[model samples]
Target: MNRPGLVASKPKNWSIFQQKMRNFKPQMRPFHLVIVYGILFVVSLFITLYGFITYSMGFEFKKEYNAQNGQIEFNVELQHSISEPVFLYYGLTSFHTNHRRFLASRDEKQLAGKDISEDALKDCDPRISDGIGIHEKYPCGLVAEAIFNDTFSIYSNSSLIKPSTANIYPSYETKLFRCPNDDCSSQRVNVTDPHFINWMRPQPFANFRKLEGVFVDGMPQGVYTVKINENIQGGQQSYQPSLKGSKYFVLSTRQWMGKRSLFIPIFALCISVMCIIVSIFYMCVSRYDQHLKEDYLQRHSMKIVQSSDKRQY
Candidate 1:
């Protein structure tokens, strides 16, 4: 009899051979791991570069009054290397005697008594009782009008002098004179000059005095001197104010070599390198997984075939 789904009376050793392909196994190398490690190395390099170009803008005042510490002293680098000017709004802040001493050191006597009738001393010294006066004493208060030339040389030939310091740079503050008051309690004063650097135009200019109060616009255009009455610490030496009106050299911003902000392009480059490394790592890992899967399937298929042949025999 014939069966619907099977053949009856088949041959003694006949059977159907069904071949099944085992799972594909891939043998991929560990390229992905190498790529990931390479990316990490490059990112570290950028951080180091940013730390190494930045500087502040300001002059190092020889006579510096520290608001925080309540102390005053000379800082040579602050005076010569700084590019910014000293600005004052109001209040009694400390100042180093370097600028004041420059004028006082001109002669054996202070500048309080010099013969200077060139221009109006009214703007130079608000306390002047007679506007123009001379002194035969050791420290005479005086204010003279003068101009400065290039190379920071004092244009005026006045006898005004200052301490012999290596960082001596001509400044407008040298034109200070005696306070025009009769009491002479305040011995030192600065000459107010128009040609000098405008301290108030861009901002409030006066560091010690008041605006429209004294020496507003009464200083000489060049060299001058102002006397100092108070003795130095422990009676060291009384100094004066001496100034010249020539073009002074200022520090440039480019000269400030310090750590600066990072550039945008460099930062972007670092990010790009990281992404590429990650992608490569992923590809390597995927390839390795595929190789393992294929190997397993092939081994299973071989075992199944060998068992079937034995059963048939």
Candidate 2:
């Protein structure tokens, strides 16, 4: 008897569950699907545009080369907007001829610090008052010593002339403006040598200036390297944990990407186009199906009404 009662109660509960399920309706509609497809299409378009822009910009090539007896041609472009004088240190490396191993020099590491400044070189020998001291060693100041020493040589292929030791002391004239209260004064300084300027100069900004020619019998027809030793210490001394300067190296004539890079933008554009086509196809199919259903319903209702009218007549 209890088994029969349990079976009966189970049927009643199942019937009530079935009734609830029959009344439940899903909220998802065709409009919701359309909106989702539109969002996806928009996102894909943006990605395609980004890929195209990046591909158009092209990539920059930077490599490092050890200073050694080799021939190199550099076509460099540099821009300097800052007021400070930038010292460019060039030197020959002591590496094996066939090794071609380019290693950053210890002197380059020392120049890569922020602790060095004009104030630090205040006691530097060969001061402006001392005149141009043509000596083997500078008593003080790394900048002075590096510039004065004939440690490196660059022979121009076009002119077929070697630059004099004194020619390294090149300068340019620029107008500097200072504002005190409402009064403004402008002064021009012969911005040639960094040693002569006494006031605290701002950080030197450099861009590729130009490439004259190659090193005489340097490296083969491959990517070569050149290290730039910057001797300006702009940051505070206390902030620097170690007393080192800044030396940066760049690899030249090296393309960052190959022919495969062109495929990236093409693939992105294809994906975007596919998404648009798919969305449009689905939208058209959905509208067509909706129209067919409405036509069928209208024809069926008309048939039922005609039958009722015939029955009434």
Candidate 3:
């Protein structure tokens, strides 16, 4: 109060801040679309690339052998481009977990194949090979016969199915892929070994949304014979197979399933996109409100000055 001679403190330059915000408001408003599109584009690009890379290499298959139950279980997804063709087949054989017994059994040879046709059916033991057929539209169109050998053995007691036939065992087959090479069209890695464990695990199924959704369990053991044409990718046909047993299950047709696990990345990407959008929106609204406040303050201050000037006159 005593300092008339001293310089009065300068008022804050709120006007400058106001003007800067005013200029920023319009620019910020138009940039919302840019922010949203940029985020979505980036996310889409990432997923697309990931799909391409994984699809080409194929998915992995995993299985766990439960020693407690002596059951081998695995979940599998077989994918082959229409460009590539493959055959899948499954069979139940009288196999034991006892290694010594398995080795000693002279009757452990692979079973001969049976066809549904009378000519083909008549050649085998009818009791074992009945009710098998080749349905053209099946997921794995060709069915192959597998032999049953009860004396077969594995390495441990937990490895064998009890009362062997106590459980209604079913076999399944689905074509995984056709060989890419011209000379090897019918070759299938899965059908080669009676106790086939993948040398490298097959890639996991794509678009998987849940862990349990695609889980499977089974054992593979057998030999496969393939037939292919020199003409790559022409004349696909199904072969009917008759087997000696009634207890087998096979997939009926090739069908599309929603991929599992796609939701994780998709959810992540959506959240990230939302964050970017909200940030931009906040920045815009802040600038707009600031501009409106500044305009009101400027107009009021001018009117007060005019009234003061008039009074002075």
Candidate 4:
């Protein structure tokens, strides 16, 4: 009797997308394992050591300061004579400029010195309209409005430590940003300033530094005072003030790797360790196989000798 959902006999069948495969394990070879993995271990170990050594050689000094929007001062005592092309930077903590909404809050056309119309700045949101929503800002955006307006100057024994005048920012960027429509008819914001250019670009990290300026010849071993004219809210009279974030004064020499990171060296160390472990495993397997081959040959030779003696008898 034939069942409703069962068959008495089965038929051969195959699917077009179906595939079957079997992998065969080859005999372990000691020489290949040792040579290949030994080279990998050596190369990766070298990179791990080199990366850490170079990263630490760069000079860096940091000091935390009060979140003051007014004048502030700091006395920096150097431990040693820093190298040429030293940088001065200001950092902010707990301010995430990389948020999806925060990063996109800018009018590229408006910042290029073109007169962007008031109605076209939908991306700026609340920043699009002024405090009362009566008038619109020229380069209407949260990024432009929250520009870190702090200025810094270094002094050694009252002699001003002048920063390098060479433009650190791109020429096209610095040149392109000017007050759209005749200086925006205000004194509170200077769109032509390079600091404004730096602020417009969003940072990847929550806590990051923006370059204040650079000292091309570097500084001699001595104490220096820094004067800061702090203006966190852009010193705007009409604009709403933002939250006061912590500030840090950073003096760092250019590192071989542009930004400071430990991921590369750590990654190299991990890879090197893995290569050595794999090499050891294969090496042990090869040694065991060699022993088995030697033992079988010895037993066969003994059997042949025994048979020859029996034939003589």
Candidate 5:
């Protein structure tokens, strides 16, 4: 519809406008643009290299074990020799600890060694009770309920290698949190346990490994037998209620930065590549634009000189 006071004009040609846009290019570019991006490329590359170097600072060895009829007993031969004071980590995949529902499911006071009324937990709602008792699941919610309870026992030859769990759980955690049942014998949770403490800390990732224990006298190159007490499907199910995941563990030595992770180096490498690519693109544009400006100036100077001579005549 047309406005009351306005009249439409003949449609203007768009082909010329499209042609001008196609040939248009910026005449002026900051001369130092290339230098700035070049520096960025160098800095990002250095970071990528540093990340890889740090990743290689320590040694890592891993083995995957699957539950068979609820039993995970396997012998893994350590191929490479690792330094002493090795750390052990049990890993689980497909467990989402960062889920909003799971994270919001536990009662803080109850976990902090205080006995609170079930009605106080409005966020937990129907999840508060699983028909176990009207009293509610002691450490209610999917978060606490889905706690990992699998135990790992590693042996060298016929001798058992006992890893130290001393100070594994925070000293203050023992004081801050407590099980509902005094002595915590009848409770489903042992808040003081190192494994329990570490698990409760929460991981924002689904596939991850948590520190299990440390071997003061690190592992050397040899065949070690790992006997896993598979509870969820075998001994007593302490992992995911359903036996549907790849359960494994690793024996690794740490640098000052802790265990080796792929996130940092990979991210740095990607940034380095992007910087180089963008730098190249901009360099090409700047060089071509410079040529266009020079050509325009040559034609303009010639016209001005000819007009001045004609006026003089």
Candidate 6:
């Protein structure tokens, strides 16, 4: 005979198991699951669309130049309007040449008044002086002076092209200097335009002001070539050097999309497709499982009815 305590504990365990099964019912219906998957798929699709729009909304033009007989030449085909001022930039992969004079001028202060002391002008002086009145001026020391020295001629196959005026304006800075008067000991003066202050800096670069006038809009579209030649004048009359082997030179209308611009759209599209595929697979599996459960329940109910009929008979 079993003990009273052991016999009573078996019924309590069975009751607990029945209660757990009742509480463990599926939290969501098939319709609700399908709705969730649909929402996720829609969100992924929106992400893909945004990326595509961002990738398609910019214009850029690029060309490469190779030196031929100590001269560089390339053709540029304009596809957009150059109604606004265009900027010219140059990038060098390796700069081993002696650009110390240019670097010094960039750091020099542009002070006002012609009667300033010689020591104050020495930093900005593009000329090499021996302090005994013997001085030699070099054009390669400053960006503005260097660009003027290297004359660039733009030519087009069409006769409608017109020449535009280009000018180089100096950048200025404000400084307070000690004055002779006691009432006002210091006075503010405008200094140089620091060449080091530029967005596309750390490389040898220069901007040809009013470059857009050279390539205006509504002009006949064709192949245009810019001929770059070094003018031998003053001290440069000895050895005339061209801008060959300068590594990189870019002529762009404005900032536009780069190669990495398409990466976002492509990546978003791939993720969207994956999300859609996963949702579809899960929906199919859920329907199949639902059908299997319904078939099993129907068979179980039929057996219960057959047993009751046998007992009644």
- lDDT at position 133, candidate 1: 45
Ranking by TM-score: 5, 4, 6, 2, 3, 1
Candidate 4, RMSD to the unseen true structure:
9.0
Candidate 5 vs. true structure, TM-score: 0.74
Alpha carbon deviation, residue 52, candidate 6 (Å): 4.4
Candidate 5 overall Cα lDDT vs. reference? 0.75
**Predicted candidate 5 versus true structure: per-residue lDDT over 1-313, tens digit per residue:** 8865555453445867445446556544545666777788788788778778877767677877767766677777767776668888888887788888778877778777787777886666546775675787667766666677778888898899889997666777776678655678877667767777788877878789888999887778899888887667222343445646567778787654457776766887888788778778888888888889999999999999999999999
Highest-scoring model, TM-score = 5
lDDT of 2 by residue, 1-313 (tens): 5698777777455657657556666674555666777787788777677666655553333433322232334443332121222223321222121211111111221122223333343334333122444421222332322221112232233223232223232232112212222232321122222322211121233222112222222222222223223232223221113433222233122112322145655676777787778778778878987999999999999999999999999
User: Over all chains combined, what TM-score does candidate 3 have?
Assistant: 0.24
Spell out the clash pairs found in candidate 6.
Answer: 110-192, 171-193
- List the candidate numbers ranked by lDDT, top first: 4, 5, 6, 2, 1, 3
Query: What is the alpha-carbon lDDT for the whole of candidate 2?
Result: 0.37
CA lDDT of every candidate: 0.33, 0.37, 0.33, 0.77, 0.75, 0.46
Q: Write the per-residue lDDT of candidate 4 for residues 1-313, one digit (tens) a residue.
A: 8785566344435443243335568854786877899899999999899888877877788887663556778788988887668888888877788988877888787776786677988888758867787877866777877777767878999999877645756676775676766565673567776677777778899888987778988889999998887664644423223545567888888756665567888999999999999889878988897898999999999999999999999
Candidate 6 C-alpha lDDT tens digits along 1-313: 9999888876555657657555556687655766776787677678677656654543344434334444555566776545544444433422322356655653232322123444545565554333355432221124323322343455677433444433322233223211223222232211222221231123343312222233334334567776655444444333324433333334544323333246656676777787677677778878898899999999999999999999999
Using all chains and alpha carbons, the TM-scores for the candidates as numbered come to: 0.20, 0.32, 0.24, 0.73, 0.74, 0.40
Winner by lDDT between candidate 2 and candidate 1 = 2
Candidate 3 residue-wise lDDT, 72-178, digit = tens: 33223333322221112222222222334222221111221212333333223322222364321111211222221112122212443211221111132112322
Cα error, residue 98 of model 5, in Å, equals: 3.0
Model 4 residue 65 distance off true place after TM-score fit, in angstroms: 1.4
lDDT of 3: 0.33
